[model samples]
Target: MTDTIFSARQRLSANMRWMRFIVLALAVFFLYSLAQDGFSGRDNVESMTDHLIVLFFCCLHIVFYIVFDRSKVLEFDAGFLYVKSKNGEEKVALSSIHIIRLSSIRLGYIRLWELVYLDEMNNSKSVSFQPLDRQVFSRFQEMVKIANPVVQINRFRFL
Candidate 1:
């Protein structure tokens, strides 16, 4: 029963983010050009600074994104959920799951899945995931039910 896999990854609104960055960079560049000083050498310096600023921000955004999202590799196998990330890897037996919740929506998919369960330490732990596809999303729900039929699963239906 270990069929869960990621069909997609990365942000669904990835295009939108790049679009915003492009627009912002263009606007900043135009402003810098308008404020160019009398000395040609100074003007060149201003332009270079503007370019550097844009590159700095764009690289910063990418770096932050990689650092945050690169941590987690999620999988499901034999009624257990495996989470391998920068922090650490932990497995959760489906039978131990007490709650399943899907929160937020984007492009016809769930943005977040919250699972609350007791881990091997018997301490309540909650894990949240951004499911990659509808099939994976539905399959996880079905798995939870198969593992513990009485478990509470709260799903959303949009008209």
Candidate 2:
């Protein structure tokens, strides 16, 4: 059997749970403050509105990360690509992948990179992580080209 050629590990899964907890706690605290203070004056209403906006963005941020957080490890061998996570591991034949999309999103100071592909059964699977190396995508693209010349690799960035 051929040795493992490339491996990409999950970046945010390790600390994402804590992040969610902290953000939720802050949301609860802000809501509590707004309720206790009571909306009476114009200044108070403005302050409460600001808090509400912040809370809205906080919830959206957590949801975005959670939705994209799926795989724990992605490994490539000579003929197959393996995706491992809490549920289990899936082995995908190289030729079975038709489209590979790589996208990066920036939120404030944090940036996340995601890899999405269609499986053999035409199911879309995504793995979100910040690659340790900037060249990881290039290297991965090169490997995919060797395995399946027809594979479509798309890369884009978002804010």
Candidate 3:
């Protein structure tokens, strides 16, 4: 069988959902601050910091959304699965994959679903892949099964 390249769509979807939730919460907080102090005149650094923080979060969410949304496909070639990020590329190898663990806590958290990849021969190359949904996770698992059937998958009750 041919090798499977796993995408990060599931993880991105979960991240996007949480980002939306955070944005909504921030909007409520902004409104609450406006209602309490009025936007007429505020020269306090704390208030400025709050606004800055919210802006910073919004920008970060936007950037993350764009990158994840754009990278719909991941390519697996030879021993590596290529990760295309906004900044550059990251290659993860099958031999480097040490453990695949399913998380129970923070069910919808973006990075909760993790596949820990470790390279004992090269300490600097250890990495992890966090795919958000069952479909993608399963696909990845299947790929790993095909690539290396001996690899262990750790399943635990999520809290």
TM-score of each: 0.52, 0.57, 0.48
Error of 1 at 141 (Å): 1.4
**Candidate 2 lDDT tens digits, 1-159:** 123334443222222434546656665676666565555444666776776776686677566546444326566555666666668887777666666654556646555655566676789777665444556546655767887798876665522
Which of the predicted structures, 2 or 3, would earn the higher lDDT when compared with the native?
A: 2
How does each model score on lDDT? 0.61, 0.59, 0.54
Ranking by TM-score: 2, 1, 3
> What ranges in model 3 sit over 4 Å off?
1-79, 107-111, 119-121, 124-136, 157-159
Q: What's the count of clashing pairs in each model shown?
A: 1, 0, 2
Best candidate, lDDT: 1
lDDT of 3 by residue, 1-159 (tens): 332333332232232333445555665665565555546577798877876766666566565555444432344544556555555666667666666666553524444444566544565432333454666557667677777777778776342
Instruction: Output the worst ten-in-a-row residue range by lDDT, candidate 1.
Output: 8-17
Q: At residue 17, what lDDT does model 2 achieve?
A: 33
Model 1 whole-model lDDT (C-alpha atoms): 0.61
> Per-residue lDDT for 155 in model 3?
76
